[model samples]
Target: MALLETLSVLSGVGGLSFGAYQYYRAKSDEKRKQELNDLADELNDLRRDIDGIVETFQSPTTKVDLSHQLDYCTKDVLAYKHETGDNALVKAEKSNGGEKVSNAGQALDLYKNGDTYPRYHLTLESGYTGYESNLVYAVSDHAVYINHLYKTLDKLQERHKGTLEEFSPGLYDGIEGLMDDFVEDTYTNILSHRDGIKVNPDSHNNIEEMGRFLFFYFWHYEGITKELESLSQLSDKIEEARTTILQASY
Candidate 1:
């Protein structure tokens, strides 16, 4: 009878122990689940913060609009110069019996032969030397402005090279080509004219060289105009790229 009673008590103790163990296990599992949930919430919050930061920098509208002011300044310079140069030429030609000299040599010959120098020649020389300061000032201002534009395009290419090419393959190529042409040929010719025989138009060989230089100058001028036009297209493509990237989920 004593053994039977002892066995019953032991059975009851074992059941209580099992029940306590099960309760502890349930509590542990619940705690672990809550921890996992908190970590997931934190991760989601971090992702949202990162997305906001990325949106701020990669916003195409903000970045592209930064260039508008500089672009306008460049446009103004080119337009002013083109207008002044053309008007000066026309006026001078009209004054000289409506016979516009086709080349620099012809103009130089007329100037050298004791003919009152055409107003255009004087105006162009002065204009080339900056309506404000000296020749160096004019060239420097123009070159610096152009270089700013070129550098901006270069950085845009570098930052979005893959995307830009995928979207507009020849865009950067055109910019680079025009820049190369200006640096190698157009800029060199202008510098040569400025430094050499610019003051002395009496030399026939020099005048001929000037004629050739002017031809190339006009060509480069046309190229620059086209380059400026391409900016609008580039702006559009950039906006498209931004929209595409924004819409895609990471």
Candidate 2:
């Protein structure tokens, strides 16, 4: 009778243990499913935010704003460069008039020898009239602008790297390519124009090209702004996912 009682108790304990194990497994599975659902929701939210940004870019109002920004940046760079020469001239005159009058005058005389009077003395000149002129600044500005746009595209690419595998991978991939193209074209144009600017600052053709390119490049800001909106949406979605995951603990 004692043996029988002992066997019954053991059986009961084993059944309870098995039941507990099943209960825990179900709970864990539920938790995992909730977490996944949360992640999906967050991704969707991110997608919406991104869509909103893109929509804004498409809006005329936003385009106008971008236009203004581009104009300001171009104007600032050009104005700065243009005045650089004048500033240099003024300084040269003042210094020459003072203690180094004789030396300064001699340098001026040497510089004024040709139409390209300051070719050799460009180093001493106040502005970017020499080989290392502010022309480089202009080039760098354009290049940097292009790079800035490219960086946004890069961000999109990074996000899509692992996360978009289950969703619309093809669409995201295409968008990434488009962004890359925009960056590449802008960079190419900048380089081409820079070469032109360096080779002939006074060439009517080159000057016109430079102006056109600058204007066009300014428009890229609009695209970048739009891309940023999309990225923001994606971030929001990610946040939503995290929140959902945390709340699903029970």
Best by lDDT: 2
Candidate 1, poorest ten consecutive residues by summed lDDT: 87-96
Q: In candidate 1, what are the lDDT values of residues 1-250, reduced to their tens digit?
A: 9999999999999999999999999998776555444433332332333233223222312323323322332333344456564312200111223224445444333333422322211113345335672111111122223334444454455554554455446755664554444344433333334322222222225433433333333223335445434433444444454444333312
The global Cα lDDT (0 to 1) of model 1 is 0.38
Candidate 1's TM-score: 0.29
User: Which residue pairs of candidate 2 clash?
Assistant: 42-237, 46-233, 46-234, 46-237, 49-233, 50-230, 50-233, 88-126, 111-117
- What lDDT score is found at residue 84 in candidate 1? 60
TM-score against truth, every candidate: 0.29, 0.35
Estimate the overall C-alpha local distance difference test score of candidate 2.
Answer: 0.40
Tell me which residue pairs clash in candidate 1: none
lDDT of 2 at 223: 50
